[model samples]
Target: MKAIVKGALAAGVLLIVGAGIVAGLRGSEPSAGPGGAPSSGPPRQRTLTIAAASDLKFALDELLKEFRAKHPGAQVQVTYGSSGNFLAQISNGAPFDLFLSADAAYPRKLAEQGLLSDDVFSYAVGRLVVWVPKGSPLPVEQRGMDALREPAAKRIAIANPQHAPYGRAAEAAMKSKGVYDAVKDKLVLGENIAQTAQFVQSGSADVGIIALSLALAPAMKDQGRYWEVPLDAYPRMEQGGAILKRAEDPELARQFRDFLLGAEGKALLERHGFFLPGE
Candidate 1:
């Protein structure tokens, strides 16, 4: 009886050891990742790069925060500049997953050139404003574009019309108000709408015709005041974007595009002073 009990105990110990050995072997093997590839550790994160208009600076920043929260494994990067300059870069084969232009025209041009992976979709309508720093004698809020004619408004700033849509819009607004000829000599050109705001903020220019979005941003909101330019003063600034044909991650880009055109995005844009597509 003693020998039988000893034999049973030995067998049980060997079985337990064998099971641990089997488990160890299985653990040592690499796991499969997305497409049945041997994964070393976690899944590789996806990257989405966007070329955006400078007018979207404040608004897009907020949108990206929400995007990252929802897609923990996705990484997003953005470059802001004149939409036309981005168009030129994209035409020349710049690597961007998406292009968010200040107007639909630039992206449509890309689509025409067969540079886009998808159709251009409008996201928002941009508004322009005549802005002046705090404590300025010019009553921009009272006189609107007429304030630019004041002798104290010697150095007026605007985005460069040659490449920036907002700049062209600013020029059009001034022209519509019959102030273009009076202030053309005093007009200082910024490379983009954001820089145009910066010019006035930094005292580089006395006043600026800049995006309403910037004027409402925390950075500039308290530093200055603005009077909205009438919608009829210039051509409509319908902002839009498209996925690039050379996008490394087209699916991810599409997801982001949907989000931008979604409810949350529209709310944030509206808060930042951008008008919605239908309104």
Candidate 2:
């Protein structure tokens, strides 16, 4: 009987010890490091990928800085390119949470194709401009599109109208001004408006039709002079944005969309020389 009692006591002690260890472990925080300090790994953050039009390159950069400041735990990555190409990629399953197109037509098409989580909405109106490097021999500002016809203006850069909205606008403007046929031979196409600006700035092209927002950016502002293409020269460049149907976080995407449509976003767009829709 004494041996049996001793064995039972040992078994009970083992059970109690095991329960205590489990309880201690369950109640304890993560393991500590040297000096008994709790280890702090990187904080978890939600990430969002925004596919935006090239015209928004500078504006979006500034807006995102403010957005991250407002939501410190949120991470945003932007890919700036031609809106038409972005739409095609998104349709083909590009992993983008948001799409901001330079023209509303692309987003509307996405909506029609069931690629959008919600209805597309206008964000801003884009403006096109003719940019010539400062001190260019051709008087682009005074002569406008006519400046391209100057002998010194041998090369002119414009975004590829095949996929870039700004390029289409540039083409339309030139056509309306009756200069397209004359200047078409001298045209050098950039992949996007940003690249078009670079072509002029880098002296690869004597002139470029680029986004007004880009011309207003500090990098280009000091290096060139621009003449805003009259709004009537081309159709309105209504820019739009939408959340993708396959977004990883629909609510987060919606928040971003709302932010862009909100006052702060509108103010930023205006500061960047973009006109709000209906303005």
Candidate 3:
């Protein structure tokens, strides 16, 4: 009986020491968070960086908002500029996860250079417009590209043809309409289509050749009127995008690319005045 009692006492003391050791260790540990993981703090956010064409500002804004709602963990950063400029930047190793170009040729060029992680895919067909502020008497809606030659239009704004696809389109449309030679001396250049629209809006230029998407944006729509440039006048502005070979997260870039190509994104782009690829 004594031996049995001694054995019980030893076992009980061992149990107590074991329990105390466990309690001490638990006290030393960080408290478990909601899912029983040590509370290291909030989970790290997944970041996606995109270089996009200026024409997509309004439409991409809404699309990104929807994407964020769907992916709360994702943080997307976008830089908008001329497609050619972005292409140069990406080629020089700019840290962009995705590149959305106003012209597919830019992305195709990147693909040829072995810089793209994925195949170039068309997103929308961009169109140009002759835009003038509502108060301006340019008659752009009636005369179309011909209005650029009007006496009242002392200054006409267009993106720089050297780098901007829209600028090239504007030049082509004017040339096609036989107005290029007449108004060539009156042209002002913007860094991109958005800036071109700003020139007309601010009265810095009497009229602007800009993207139809910009002319349809809420702010631009309220302040200006526009006429769609004839499609045949300029080469088709088939916009496209590609994932970068150096993307920090290729899968995340791909997911966003898929979202942009999805039906919801298509509807949003259409609402912003972008024509769908098929229609």
lDDT of 1 by residue, 1-279 (tens): 000001112221111100000011112235687899898795555778899898888788789888877776677778888888899999999998999999899999999999988889999999999999898899998999999999999788898888999989999999999988887888888778877777777776899999999989888888888899999999999999999999998998999999999999999999999999988
lDDT of 1 at 14: 12
Candidate 1: give the clashing pairs. none
Model 2 accuracy (lDDT, Cα) = 0.80
Best by lDDT: 1
Candidate 3: tens digits of C-alpha lDDT, residues 39-147: 8765545778888888888888778878877776677788878788888888898898899999999999999999988899999999998888888888877888878
lDDT of all predictions, in order shown? 0.83, 0.80, 0.80
Ranking by lDDT: 1, 3, 2
Model 2, residue pairs in steric clash: none
Q: What's each prediction's TM-score? A: 0.87, 0.84, 0.85
Worst 10 residues of 3 by lDDT: 14-23
Question: lDDT (0-100) at residue 171 of candidate 1?
Answer: 90
| CA RMSD, predictions in order | 21.2, 21.4, 22.4
Question: What TM-score would candidate 2 get against the native?
Answer: 0.84
**Which candidate, 1 or 2, would have the higher lDDT against the true structure?**
1
